[model samples]
Target: MAVLRTLLGQALRTTRLSQERTLREVSSAARVSLGYLSEVERGQKEASSELLASICRALGVRLSDVLRDVSETLSVIEPEPAPVLVPVAVPAMAGPGTTAAELRSVRRPVRDVVAAA
Candidate 1:
């Protein structure tokens, strides 16, 4: 599973690096401590909503844009859920007059099979 903080941190770091700005520069502009900013960028710490806004302001990038980038990255890296197949028991022989509803009533799932994609 992809962690939201990890993706967010990557997006922030990529944006900062693209702007050729150092941690000190962004932290100073964002009015946050360099150590804290570094931790947030490394994904060791999760930034609060206010701190995130401040960082976005310092980076001169919209918070929505950063979130969108993170979301896109997450979609690409996230794995799809495995499909489940249920084994249904059916009678070996059925009468010619047996109705579909009767067959369904007699059927029961014996086991569940999870198929990986």
Candidate 2:
């Protein structure tokens, strides 16, 4: 599973680093302890929504922008869905013990499959 906090922390750190700012500078501007800010940036601590907003403000960025970047990053890191396996009832004419490979292929989108049932 993708860790939201870790992604959020990475986004925050990337933004800060891109601005060529130090942890001390941002922490001071955000009115948070340097240690806590460091922890947040390192993904060692999960920051509250309010703290995230404050950090964004200190970094001169919008919270939405950071979240958008994180969302994009997560989309790339998220795993693709596993292939679905559905048993197909073979006709008596086919054989008594037909293998899966011999079954009729039903390739449908997930929504289509749901709607079909």
Clash count per candidate: 0, 0
Over 2-100, each residue of candidate 1 has an lDDT whose tens digit, in order, gives 788878888899999999999999999999999999999888999998999999999999999999889998889899766543535557676897789
Question: Candidate 2: global Cα-lDDT?
Answer: 0.86
Off by over 4 Å in 2: 83-110, 113-117
What is the overall TM-score of model 1 with all chains considered together? 0.69
- Per-residue lDDT of candidate 2, residues 14-114 (tens digit): 99999999999999999999999999988889999999999999999999999999999999989988766555444556666766556655444565566
Q: In angstroms, how far off is 67's CA in candidate 1?
A: 0.3
Best by TM-score: 2
How do all models score by TM-score?
0.69, 0.70
Q: What lDDT score is found at residue 96 in candidate 2?
A: 61
